[model samples]
Every structure is written in C-alpha cells, then in structure tokens.
Target chain A: MSRVLMKGNEAMALAAIKGGCDAFFGYPITPQNEIPEYLSEHMAKEDRVFVQAESEVAAINMVYGAGGAGARVLTSSSSPGIALKQEGISYLAGSEVPCVIINVMRGGPGLGGIQPSQADYNQITRGGGNGDYHLLSYAPENLQEAVDLIKQSFDKADAYRNPVMIAVDGLLGQMMEPVDLERTPDSKQRERKEWATDGDAGRRGKANTIVSLHLDPNKLEEHNLALKEKYDRMVENEQRYERLETEDAELVFIAYGSTARIARSAVESLREEGYKVGMIRPITLWPFPENAFKKLPDTVHTLLTLEMSLGQMHQDVKIVNQGRYHLDLYARTGGVVPEPEEFIEKAKAILKKEDAA
Target chain B: MNSDTVYRPKQGLTDREFHYCPGCTHGIIHKLVGEVLTEQGLIGEAIGVASVGCSVLNYVYFDCDMQQAAHGRAPAVATGIKRVRENHAVFTYQGDGDLASIGLAEAVHAAHRGENITVIFVNNAIYGMTGGQMAPTTLIGQKTTTSPFGREKEGTGEPLRVSELLATVPGAAYLERVSVHDPKHVRKAKKALEKAFDTQMKGKGFSLVEFISTCPVNWGIQPRESLDWAVENMIPYYPLGVFKDPEKEEEDD
Candidate 1:
C-alpha cells in the first residue's frame, strides 16, 4: 500500500482498476467526469476497456453487458446522468449482474446544479429504477472513504450478485484527502468464472441462459419473491452504521454522506460547548442502520435529521425513532450544503429546548 | 409414424411455449437465431440483448446469456458487453418502434462509433406490444391504434428506412435488409446473421441486419395473410437487399 492524496472521483477510478475492473463505461457529467476522464487515459494502458458512450443510457447498458460477461465493470454519473441510467440499472438488478455504479450526487429533480448535495437519497436508497429491487448503497463522507468503499463495492456486488452503488456527494467527489492505495486481491486468487458468461468451455455441459424475463406471471412472481428473500438476507447481513458519542446523549444527529460529515463537526463543537449531543451516521443507506437508532437509550430525547434534500431521509429516521423520540428536520437543497457552524447552532438550540422541557 | 419419428420442431426452445400469436414471424426468427447459435458453437460465447417490444421474453427462448434492454437501448448494452469481454459475441434483437423511435440515439451512435457488435433489427411496421400503435416505420396510409386515420406522410413523416440510412454512416461496416416472408428470404437473413457474426469475429466494426418481419396479430389480418401483406405492402416501401458488404467492398478496393 502507498499513501497518496487524491480526489474522491480519481480515487474511485483507481480503485475500480485495482479491483480488476475490465471495463469503464460512462458519459460526461458534472463532479464525476473526472472518473471517466481518468479511466479513458489509464484503462487501455491496463489492458482494460474504456468507452465514452453517447449517453448515460448507453454507458450503463455497456456496464450491463460487461457485467453479464462476468467482468468487474463500472459506470459513474451525477444526478441527471444517473437518471438516464435508471432503466439500465434496473435491468442489471433484475438480471442479477454484479457491477459497481458510482453516483456523485448533485441537486436534482431536474438539472439541479453541479454542487455537493445528498438530494438523491430517495432515488439511491429506494429503487431508482422500475421494479422491485434494492441497490447496496454505500455513502462515503470523505475522499478516503470513497476509495475504500469503491474497492469494497465490487466485492459486495459479486457477493450479493447484485449492483452496488457508491453514493457520494459532489463534495466528496471534488475534495482531496490522504489515502493509502491498496492493491486488490488478484482475480486469479478469487473464485474463477463460476457464475459468469465466460464461454462455458470446461465447467458446464451447455450454455447457461442469463435473463430476467419469465413471461409466465407465476414464474415472474416467484423470481421476484426470491429477489425479496435475497434483499432480506442483505438487510440482515450488511447493515452498517457509526455512533459518535451516542452513549449518554440527550440529542442525536442523524445524517449520512456529506451531511454526516457536517454533523460530525457539529457533534465535536457541541461537545466542546458542553452539550450532550451525539451523531449516528449511516454508511449503508439501503440496509440502513435502523437497529443502531433503535439501540439508543430512552434518555435520548430528540433526534435531528439533517440532509441536503428536504425531508427525504427524515422519514426513515422517524420510522426508526418509532415515535419514541421527537423528530426535527433540517435540510438545504438546490446545491447548498449545510455549514458545520449552522448545524452546531441548531444542535445547541435543540438541547436548550430539551432542558427547558 | 411414432411421435418421436415425426418431424418435430427444434428442441432449443423452452417447453413453456411462447406468448407470440399463431403465424407470428417472431417465433420463426427466434428459431433461426437459436439454430445459428447452436450450429456455430457460439452458444456459450454468445450474449443476446433483448429489446423492448413483443420480443422482450426472447431471453426465455435463446439458450445463452440474455439481457433485456429498455426500448432501443440494446445496441448500447451490447457495445458495453462486447467492449469488456471482447472474446464474447454480443448481439441485440430489436423491433421497429424500439429501434427507430425512442432508442434512435443509441442505435445511431453505436453504428457511428463502429462498435464491434451485431444488431438484428426486426421491422414489423407497427408496434405489437402496445396494441398496434403507429411506429416510426409504419407505412404510408397504414391504419393502427395511434394512427387510426392512417399514417399521413405530411403529418407523421415518411417511414424510416434504417438500413439505407445506416449504410451511409461511415462507421457501419456491413448493412443488409432481408425479409423473412419466404424460405429463400429466411435463408438469406440467416446468411446475413452469419456474416454479421463473422465481421465481429474479424474485428470489423458495426454490422446490422434489418429483417422485414410480419406482425400478423397486430395487423388485424389472418396469420397466413399477413405474409402476403408484408410482401405486397411492406416490401416495396422498405426494399430488400444488402446495402453494404465490407468484405466485398474491400475486395473491389
């Protein structure tokens, strides 16, 4: 492993290469374009394929194809581009292809602006595309976490036989941080071509059909039910969350991605100001850290949900709180990231109100 | 004769039976593709991207790695797959509406970039999956659900001739349009498929074969009569011939 300072987007591309990715397919999009630009220059040198597909739709489809062939493949885009990829992502999920998708989220509902925002929480955590499926969504708050999560994303995608998304905000994608570049385990050292479309030369007797369509309504339903079962298994096995000083705290700050980064700063500042404020940051947004919130002590009086989008993830926080605690929502959208000082002020206010009550 | 001795259809298809209507050319086309994969020993290395439309369930019939693509996005997906696993043969099976309508950008760009992939375009004139809607390839004065008053050239514009249009694109290496209404035409289409596959194997860029097929059920005609309709009405509008053959052109050059 070698230490290097790298931007989140550049680190993700390098991580994909280190993870033995055979292809990188993408179109130009804000905040994440650095990823594709880096791969376009380096992938061919590594004997990997690189394509600047005409559109995000094409780039994602390319990922679907390469993934079906059992190659570690990836595609990255910002909000608008990711919207175009929803259909392709849905197909990959339905077909049970293992691939990594990186979304350096920007503000959106439509061409929202090229700034860091966790506005895509609903689209990422809930199914972004059509049909019943869940992406293993990893939210990285900083550049180092971005590289680490991307490397782990490939393993999780293959392990679950589903698409894994490294959902970082534009802040993380654009920021530079110190990271130790670790080489991924060689592909030869791992399980070789057991479930891929690598020409059935020696293993199977005949060609294996990989398809998501079972025209019969009954069979399709069964396939979907099986997918639900797999999702349940993922929820049970892959839930990850972090607690910062939540042990005897009166108020908990619930956030993720960049918002969690701001919340962490606020937690530190409030602790210095002598307030019992802590933070719960979710690393996996899909298999959300519901149990972590549930484990909070009864003395935890208020839970403040901070996000870049208006009240998207607050619903999840409320659901986990289960009416046991009062829920407060604070959000800034349209590419505006909440300042750490602002979050600290809000935390102080909530604690003061709690004391008065 | 015993049931086993009788002339039975190909065993490559699933026993589940297709939902395609009787006399539909999709079943025949599927059989041809299956037979080609089986014959060429390409089944293991072949991955098919099924397009949106009547043939969405194509994954069920083809005994290879099959992926269902959004309307017209098959070519893009095939490009991605072929680029990554260059050793694998990738192809897209798309219909008229899916290819010429919403997925036009993907189809055109894939051909323009000379991506080493095969596209099997099925031009059935009308949208069969969505209850006979007017398609980008709907013939002049052809009446359907969306074009109840008939497809007017002035308002709806002329039907797109994809093979002719694609042949002019510099990136396309081989472009052919064949009809499957007759046995001879079917054989020609299969040969075209073989050539397309061969071109990819040889690292030749973008090869496309457009099949003029009959959607008898959606045409509101008897399945047998639909073949005659395709021959008389559809063939003249969309002619049948190889527009460009790179190997032959190279020989001449």
Candidate 2:
C-alpha cells in the first residue's frame, strides 16, 4: 500500500514475484544483473525456484522446460544475451509455452555497449528467432509503468500461451523511482494447463508432450496458422498507447520506452513555444498501437519518430503511416541517450522542411 | 492357474512403435528406461525430456509426461522441470551428439549444480539422425560421413568419455557406463538405469548412465555384426563399469 523508492531492475523482479512467478532461470548480463541478483535471494526466501544458468541459451531453455511443465517462469538479460536466447524463444513460441522475458536493453549489433539503447526494438517486436512468431512485447516509458507491465505480462503470457517480452532501455533498468508495488493490472484468471508435462498430466490418464516439432508439412502449416490466429487476436485486443496533447497538433513525435519520455518533454517545450507539437507513446510494441496513428486529427500531417536506435521503430511508423503523413526520423546509436532538446530541434527542422516543401 | 507371464509390454512405454532405425540400439536403451520406470512404480510420476536425434520422438514412446527439448539441451530442460516438479522423476534421454557436443555445457553444469535428475545418455559414436556424421564420441580411425577417409585424431579430438568426465564432478551421485550388445550386458544396462533413477527418487543429486550403443546402418554393418563391433571396439575405449557411485562409496565407508 505504501510507496518505496526502488531500482528499476529490482522493481521488475519484485513485480514478477507479485505476478506469481514460480521460477526464474537466467545468466548474468550487464545493466540487468540486478534482476537476477535480487531474485536469487528473494525467490529462495519465497520458497520459489531460482537457477543461475551457464549461459543465456541454457537459461531460456530452462524457462522453456519450466513453462512446458506449466510453471510461471521468467528470465532477464541484456541485448546480446537476448540474442543468445533466440533459439529457445523460437522453441517456446513454436510449442506455445507461456513465460515472460525481460530485456533491459543496451546497444548492440554485437555487444556494442553497456549503456541505455533501444536497439532491440526490432528483435523484441519482430520474430528474433526463426520462423513466423511474435512475442507480446511492451516497451514502458517509466519505472512505474515498467513495473505494472512486468506484473501483467505473466497473465497475458498465460492467456495467449505465448512468451511476453518487456523491453526497457538500460536507463530504466538503472534508474531509481518511487513505485507502489501494490498497484497491478487486474489478474486474469488462468485456466489449469492440462497439457503441461508435469507428471500429473500423465497420472490423470492422458500424458502430455510439450513439443514444437510437427514433421509433416501439412501439420506444421496447421500449427503455424493456429498460432497466427492467436496473434491476430492479440492485435485486435491488445494495442495500447498514450496520446499526449494531440487534439489540434500539426506535428506528432512517435516514440516508445525511454525515447518516449524524451519526446514527451519535447512536446511540452514546443507547446510552450506556441508550436503545435504532440506525442504518441506506444506501450505495446508488438501489436504496435497502430490505432493511435489513425486517431490523429486531420490537421496533423507530419510524424517524426525518435529512437535510441537508428530508426528501428521508425520502420513500424512508416508501415502504419501508409503515405498518410510526412515521415521523418532522428536516432542515436551505440548507447547514446538523446536529450529532449534534440527531439525539439528535430521536430522544428521536420516542420520547417514541411513548410518549405 | 495360468503360467506366470515372463515378460509384458512396459506400462512406462506408450503403445507407439519406436521410430529408431532397424539396427539402432536406441530401442533397447528406451526399453531399459521404460522398464526401469515401470518396475520402480515411478511411471505415473516420471517426466522425461527427449533430445533431438534419432530418439527425438521418444516423447511418443514414453507413456509418462514428456518434453521434447532443443538439440543437446535436454539436461537443462530436465533441470528446469525437476526444480519445479520436485516430486516428479525427471530425466533426459539424450544421444551422444546431443549430450556431448553442442549441449556439453548444459550437461556438465547440470551435474555440477547437483540437480536431482537422471540423464540417460546413449553414446552411439556417430550422429544417426543426420545421416552418419561424426559425433563428439566418434572414435579415432572410425569412418563417418563427415570423416570420409576416417576420423583423424589431429583434426578431431578422440572420443569423449562422458561418464568419466561427469564422474569427476563432485555433485554427480551416480555415473556408469554400460552396454547392451548382449543379453547379460542388456540386463546390466537396465540395472544401471534403475540405480540412476533410484538416486533421483531418493533426492540424491545428478545421475547419468551412459550406454555404449551401436548404430548399424550408420556403421555400415549388419545389426548382428554391430553388436560384436560395439563389444570388441567400444568396451575397450569407453570401458563398462560404475564410474562414480556415491551411495556405494557411503556403504563402503
């Protein structure tokens, strides 16, 4: 009921416990190490399971194993570590295993840096692993939002029977903020997983096999289509975004995660200066809040995307824009955290270009 | 009264026929595991992790709950299952290629962590599912698809002795290398499997039984000839015996 100042990584870890996470399997990685470090002590105190796996591959596979056994499991890592987890993630998606993964992202094409960067936007939203798959991904802009989303991700993962990913930049991971852990999204009642391979399924007369392999081409196609149907449901029901001061705005800054916080500040600054600037912050990056763009007023013509990566989210904006609006992008790479002033400058240049044209 | 039945289909194994190659020893090994679980009355509480290989579909063959893990990741998967389902008899049925090659880290670390689980490692010395490629346990001078002329000791290392390697780990409660080339050794292999499972049920840490198995089709030999080949070649190198037995050591002490 009371608020406490907590580190971002630690808050997410505590939120997982509140969300009824039964097990955590992860290997150490930079900027996100606190998640495991905190859980190692607290998970045991709660009489839950905690395993420090040998590598990211082992950790995620462990998650697959636990989830296949119908346990609420979680794993956290940085960008490169998440890249290592793609193989297991693919298997989890293919098998329809429910678990939550947190990527307190840092820069990377390959171990680029250990500072805050949204470079994993594409990796988390798109299928980082092979084949056609998608995670219900969230990119929260603040510590409180990150905590709430991390708590709700478990139920959402169970509801969809798929992995849910929370992608936050390293800044959110390392920053400290006051948060009320008691506040959580409404918990969806989870049906018992009768298909889980926890021995009980066998004892009850119908043994279960949690597998992704469908050797027959026809069967594999059927499975893929079934998964596509689930994903389509997510797109219809789960698109989430926050619109800020966009009623009569002509220019909108599109961003998410830490970048969105910066864009919000820029929007405020431009509004104070008598410029009609607004922002659209996407909370769910996978079923990316395309509805937010559709609701933009007729006066809005230009959409500028700001990102910690070099235009990863910008690609999504372009797709949803469909030539409906003038699009532009401003980005910083390799762990560079751009300031609000930069977004303001970019917005001004974009509007000036539109006026000139 | 009717004469007592000498043998029956194991309740632990499902009705599905094994998909292993005709000459492959995976069937014999699978039977041993199935019988072990059934005999110990652990079938109802057992959870098996099936690894990728010719035995990838062992999930269909095992009547108990099963999880098919990524190639070589069965050990890690079993660890995850056992940690959560502590009362369940969790085990991984992995081939030499799956346990000794890409999944070596997961296998060794699982043992090192003293996870209370059993691993049924089938060391056939060649990759069977992928058409006779050289495996980590492929012996020197052996010819495989990948080692066309023969396996060179310099180009590729000597066969990995997984039982001996795991025996060195302090957490391993039981480690044994057995073969099923003959009826006597087949019984011995099943006994080793029983002991490994018993260790897990008793809450003792990691246990593994390595079967020096044969892949006849991959070896380009008759099924009958392959048994003799395994006895003559593999036993000398992989040496059948209990490599580590913490329970026996305690009794000796």
Q: Which candidate is the best by DockQ?
A: 2
Ten contiguous residues minimizing lDDT sum, candidate 1 chain B: B6-15
lDDT per residue for candidate 2 within A1-357, as digits (tens), equals 779999999999999988889999999999999999999999999999999999999999999999999999999999999999999999999999999999999988897899999989889988999999999999999998988898899999998999999999899999999998878754554676887998885448888999999999999999999999999999999999999989999998898999999888889889999889988999999999999988789889889898998998999999999999888899998999999999888888878887898
Model 1 C-alpha lDDT per residue in residues A288-318, reported as the tens digit of each score: 8787877787678999999999999998987
Best by TM-score: 2
DockQ for every model comes to: 0.55, 0.82
TM-score of each: 0.93, 0.98
Per-prediction interface RMSD in Å = 2.4, 1.0
Give the per-residue lDDT digits (tens) of candidate 1, residues B57-160: 88777777666776788898788778766777788999999999998888899989998888989999999999999999999999999999899999899999
TM-score of chain A of 1: 0.96
| Model 1 alpha-carbon drift over 4 Å, by segment | A183-189, A201-203, B1-19
Query: For model 2, what is the alpha-carbon lDDT of residue B115?
Result: 95
Per-residue lDDT value at B164 in model 1: 92
What global local distance difference test value does model 1 have? Answer: 0.85
Runs off by more than 4 Å, candidate 2? A185-191, B1-6
